[model samples]
Target: MGAAQGDDQDEWSFLFGMLMDDATKRGLAHDELYFLSDELLRFSLAYQGYEPLLEAVADGELSRLRFMHEIWRAMPEHFYVDLALKLGAELLAARQ
Candidate 1:
């Protein structure tokens, strides 16, 4: 597969894993999980720059529950411009 296609697959995996982690922790029923996933998709899009969070439902990078938790913990309700700028650098470094 091409790099772009691979990246899309990875993103999908990650999003799905996150949804499952949240659903399991909250003891969500199947229908509830579907509803909650929609809410989370909005938040994930605005926070992570990923539209349609389902695209990352299969992301390999987000394998463990810890990864999902960490991502949530790292985000705040509102971003501070200065802090975000600094954290952007840190994020780039961490990704490497």
Candidate 2:
């Protein structure tokens, strides 16, 4: 990956880590947290309108909170919830 891409990945990974840590503290399991992070990363990459947000984050024009806010606003609520629940269930099933 190019420098900017690498930096974006690093930044996103850090952001996701924070989210996972928070979720874990909230009583969710690590498997769900990992799946959530992976799905969020994939969504950020595939979402068409996410480029500007990514660029802003990479350029330091946006705080991590702002970037996450934009993502939350951009993604449909039902879709996000469905994705989380589906992935969480899949991971739980695999572990059993």
Candidate 3:
């Protein structure tokens, strides 16, 4: 689902950097930042090469949340909701 092998590493790194920048700018806590960063990296990996998908996500298009839900569903069975909840909290705090 990700980019061709090695190319994925760069994409992941870029996504992490984006999340870190966003989290820092939003004054998010360390744990929240890490959780959001990881989730965002997963999204980036899942949407590799789909510039339209990335743009839709960045612009918060209506489907963005659905896309995230799909990514979460498609992720490994071991993935948990705790991280998502934490990120939600951070987002709520940021909006307040």
Top TM-score model = 2
Clashes of 3: 0
Q: Tell me, by lDDT, which candidate is best.
A: 2
Worst 10 residues of 1 by lDDT: 61-70
* lDDT of model 3 at position 52: 50
Better of 2 and 3 by lDDT: 2
Query: Per-residue lDDT for 12-47 in model 3, tens only?
Result: 445555655676688874335454443664555464
lDDT of 1 by residue, 1-96 (tens): 347553243455466567776777889743355444445555554664433223444463332333333344433334555688889999999999
Q: For model 3, where is the 10-residue window of minimal lDDT?
A: 69-78
TM-score against native, each model: 0.29, 0.31, 0.30
- List candidate 3 stretches off by more than 4 Å: 1-7, 33-96
Question: In angstroms, how far off is 40's CA in candidate 2?
Answer: 4.8
- lDDT of each model, Cα atoms only? 0.50, 0.58, 0.49
Alpha-carbon deviation at 30 in model 3, angstroms:
3.5
TM-score for candidate 1, please give it.
Answer: 0.29
Cα lDDT of candidate 3 equals: 0.49
